[model samples]
Target: MSALGLKIIDESVQQANIWINEVDYRVGLVNKQRAYRLLRAVLHALRDQLTPDTAAHLSAQLPIFVRGIFYEGYNPSSMPAAIRDKDDFIARVVAIFGPEPPEDITGAIGGVFDVLDARLSPGEMAQLRGQMARDIRALFAD
Candidate 1:
């Protein structure tokens, strides 16, 4: 059923698609591209907020393609950028979304967190959530 023919590559791609589709479904997005924007934005914003060590550990658990997306513009030396609070984090995501912003930014962000809850190990997710500021953590609260 994999058009790629190579089983491992095909399976990895399928796993990545599952996450993307889940994000799309959770956000009620009719457009896959829009869902991708949301995922990429949130992933990058969250990655920059984590300590380099924690970020690496978290990315290691991501699916192959998703991992690449998570690390797209990463610079460990300049990382764990002083994104101390929720507004700063939301501002970063809004900048990523650019002109056509979502009507419900909180919902969009929460939607990504909701899908990731299933993909990530509960312990890892809990630790990562704990490290973030309370306001930011609320964005991911169930």
Candidate 2:
């Protein structure tokens, strides 16, 4: 008989692997580490801009293991910041990548947006996209 703990752990690990693979596929990278860095950076930016309720809703759509990454270091009390400008949104995302941010920041955000768009429903994705500024919304258009 399979142990319950093993089952749960196995399932979670599998889901995490799937998510990483998906990110790798979306970003056109064979490197898992690059995919993970892109994933975490984009997630943190998106999380900071969402309301607690909306953030929770988005988390529900994520893989079980990825959901933890989505909420890592989340502080709802200080979130949903006024980010009506695309530069502001981009800057937030860039900062997450550390001192030497990637040059193709828009592509990075677009890649994560594509993954989310594929995993989420059209309407649900639109809801989240609508929350962003016009230029930010265009990231999904690509």
Tell me, by lDDT, which candidate is best: 1
What are the RMSD figures for all models against the true structure?
Answer: 1.3, 2.2
lDDT of 2: 0.80
Write candidate 2's Cα lDDT for 1-142 as tens digits: 4456677778887888877788777767677877777788888888888899989988888877788888888899998977777788788777776765556778767887888888887877877987877787888854
Alpha-carbon TM-score of each model against the true structure: 0.94, 0.86
Q: Candidate 1: misplaced stretches above 4 Å?
A: none
Tens-digit lDDT string for candidate 1 (74-97): 999998888979999999998877
Instruction: Quote the lDDT for 100 in model 1.
Output: 79
How much does candidate 2 score in TM-score?
A: 0.86
Clashes of each: 0, 0
| Model 1: residue 125 alpha-carbon error in angstroms | 0.7
Q: How does model 1 fare in lDDT?
A: 0.89
